[model samples]
Target: MYPKLPSLMDTRIPTFLKNFNLQAFEVVGYSAINAKYQADFCHVSVKDAVMKGGGRRVHGWALWEFESHIVGNFHSIWERPDGTFVDVTPPKVGTKVIFAPDASLKITDDGTHQTLYQNRTSDPGLPYIDPLGNAANHPQWMLENSNPSLIEYCKSLGWNNASMA
Candidate 1:
């Protein structure tokens, strides 16, 4: 039998927050996993256009462990249940992915930076966040922008969501 994988909530979340000096935030959404492939990791293409003139994009077959707990602009956690967070996105290149919730909070805390575009209309009840842009939205972005071959690969793996799962 396969070993039980650790939960992202129990492991990676704390380390991600502590590493970046961020406060805990709610999990917004997540890609559904197929029961048969529960322990297997999938590759996803994440777009990092938030930094430096539309930014560069990276494509690879790295195992993706996604969690949406933290409130920010990042899409995937790239973290293993073993508490290792990998930044497979292009923003930091080879560095580990860090959620900059503190930076996001600072913008929201400062009223002057407020703008309607920054606030997510999907969930109106929540406080305004991501004055710059939220990486949290990137998974969907990746799905929307992904090629047909990648989409087929994801579907074959039982990623049922319209977006990458």
Candidate 2:
């Protein structure tokens, strides 16, 4: 059993996301047309990490992109006074969140269009601070420490495949 997680509407947005410089880059070619008329917003993706010792885990959240339209399970970005980002989708008690510097952009196959944004980092093992205040192996460690309430919440949100792993 696990403690109740915060309500989805109660989590706050991070300051960096709130003040994210949308004008820092321009949409080019075909994507630009979509940007002009669509509602621009940010995307958040939930990630997991497990500890090496046992059934301890920590979940991490990443900002996927600043988009002209909502896509998938993406949620609005939130900020903290210290300029860190937070995703309220999961249980806040034992979760760890991170921002991958490398995921802050998107490029076209033909090298014609480039968009400034952030997305999930490819490396699942990215080191992050755990709830215990120690560095833990991500994704894997997070899986081990899965919270029942969060897992149930995720399932309620339609992540039927959500697992302790």
Candidate 3:
């Protein structure tokens, strides 16, 4: 059974510092100007935009929906001087993205970005431990709740903790 996905209003969202606003932004005219793999370098793109002109960096999470779960990946976007937010990174597919701004989250030195995963359905029959965004620190939780593919992906990254029982 799948765990139900939490909305911004859900009290279960751990460390959810603020309401996750549903946002849709346009990719800037020069989004791909200096970006290599645009989709993978959102932080860089936003940073470059801020450096080039007059805009502040906005930190938040970008939500990606999968069949089994919805993942919220820590991300950054650009807020123009006019107070309008825009994604300076070229999206991999569609022009739109689901973004949630969290003023509290920021890029850190560890280089290990955080991601939150929530089940698509709330099935009480299943073991419904809430998914932690920082699975790298929770080996046991990773083994139990994370999908097999994700565990394998972690292994490829040399995350030995994920391989532990």
Whole-model lDDT per candidate:
0.31, 0.27, 0.47
The lDDT, on a scale of 0 to 1, for candidate 2 is: 0.27
RMSD of 1: 16.4
Judging by TM-score, tell me the better candidate of 2 and 3.
3
lDDT tens string, model 2, 56-110? 2112233322221111111233333354344433422334223322223322222
What is the Cα-based lDDT of residue 70 in candidate 2?
A: 12
**What is candidate 3's lDDT per residue for 1-165, written digit by digit as tens?**
322324444432332222233333222322444434256556545665676777898866555443344445556778888997787776654554556676655444222322332321112232122344322322122123254654454444345433211
Where does model 1 exceed 4 Å of error? 1-22, 25-43, 46-71, 92-97, 100-162
Q: How many residue pairs clash in each candidate?
A: 6, 25, 3
Error of 1 at 156 (Å): 14
lDDT per residue for candidate 1 within 1-165, as digits (tens), equals 211222435454454455445565332222222232222122233221112123332222121132333332333333334433344333312223333223332111122221112222113243223534442332222123244654564565445432332
Model 1 residue 82 CA deviation (Å) reads 1.7
Q: Compute the lDDT for candidate 1.
A: 0.31
Clashing pairs in 3: 3-121, 4-121, 4-122
Ranking by lDDT: 3, 1, 2
Root-mean-square deviation of Cα positions for candidate 3 versus the true structure, in angstroms: 10.3
